[model samples]
Target: MPCRWLLAPGKALRTRFARPLRCDVNNSRRMLSFLSSMSPDNAELRAEVARTRLSVAVGCITEVRGADAIVNCANEHLVGTQLPYINLDGAAGCVFHCVDGVVHKRAGPELHEACMSLAIEEGSYTETWGGIRCPSGQARVTPAFSLPHCAHIVHVVGPPWPSDAEELRDAYSAGIKAALAVEGPEARPAIRSLAVPAISSGIYQWPRDMSWAAAVQSLGGHLLEASLRRGGAGELPCPQDGARSGLDHVIFSAWDAASGREVEECLRRWVDGTLTEDGLL
Candidate 1:
């Protein structure tokens, strides 16, 4: 599939600072500042900008209520972390333990093979969850088990960053594709997938700003495109179009409160006129 790119307008503001003159060394006088002449309320705008930027960076992870299924960032082994030991041990242990019994009972040997095969073809199933041994080491996908609400847990490895910018863009695009691909007779009515921060910034060591930019751009593009497809204005095939089609809703999960707020604000801005050009809301 051809990759889609969405660009958001820049909102950077520039501030100027006065330079000290060497000739004034003997003078104990200071030049009057224009900033002081302005209303003290101006500082509020600067503070608001700072707050907004921080919110944007943190991103969001929502529960996606009423979704068919929620995707978890899994470990490679597919054994979720055990609970009770979660806080002390970390996410891996918690996830492993949470779904271990359920997954082990249902995963079976065939499922394992299928997962391995998919992992081989698509890098790691969940790109944001695992780590690489070194800069040049091969990537690993985090493992996750299936739950009852969703028919299938579609695992895909998002591309590592600092590489081809276009390819990185495609990874986000592919995630939507994966979600769409699961729309068959046996699929659920509303499919929801959770996305992490992606592989570049965390253990993968990709720059945070760049990674975030790519994620927002790609996800926003796909969502808009999907909407268009469903509306019948676009040529793209949407699973929801078919009779008895088992597809509804696409959800992106943010990892923390700050991140969640960022996504929410972005979506709100996109929905309103503030961020209309970005096609994200």
Candidate 2:
């Protein structure tokens, strides 16, 4: 018989099913109770989620060195070459230059045409969350030339932000969902997702806190739900032993010190039991 999987809210699961994996079943039950007793508040949960997202963002800045795919906060034109580090500083420039020269050389024109077809303009690029308009039907493949250790480039238009806009929130949610869906059909055993600071907040004029909140909520919700489904329903692909392949890890890479500090503080509160009971931290 196939194994079963279940999807439950993180809080509820932590409360009702926080058990240890042990050879003996009774000890596991005891462990669950202990964890339940220590559950954090919703506020704390929200804060922690924000902090975790921030940490992942910071890590992404450095994590690109070994990832299979790195999602870019690309413009509608896919004119990634215009970016400061990629274009100006030779030392920093080569870091993101994928090995596949074609992807690097052609990404701009190819992305531009796709955006134009969708009626998305350069001014509107960061405003709306544009989908990858590549000619290829697959979301994982980008026109950028491949780089060492990195197999693919996933292009997702970060939702242009007033930061708090519902559209932006939806875009963040959609982006994560899209990435997760890719792994759903693949034979690969694992995949990773990395997000840059969405548009609108930086040069786009979006609010920072709201943008941060939206991202955390979307990614955390997806991860928690996906983990449950994998563990309970067995819908997720697993290894030959029948263990499902879910998000092995999700990271947020902050590009600067301020961003990094903000993320770390939130994480500290979550782990230290400073968050509220409702899980909103």
* Most lDDT-accurate candidate: 2
The whole-model lDDT of each prediction reads: 0.37, 0.42
lDDT string, candidate 1, 1-281, tens digits: 12223221232332212234334532222112212212243334323322322223232222234344433323333333332333344543333222223343344445455444432223433343332211121222223233333445543333432255444444554545555555446554234343334433432233434444455545544434343344421233454464222223345455556545655655444333243212232
Query: Looking at candidate 1, what is the lDDT of residue 212?
Result: 47
Candidate 1 — worst ten consecutive residues by lDDT sum? 29-38
| Model 2 ranges with Cα > 4 A deviation | 1-66, 81-146, 181-190, 193-200, 231-237, 240-246, 266-281
Assess candidate 2 and give its TM-score to the true structure.
Answer: 0.50
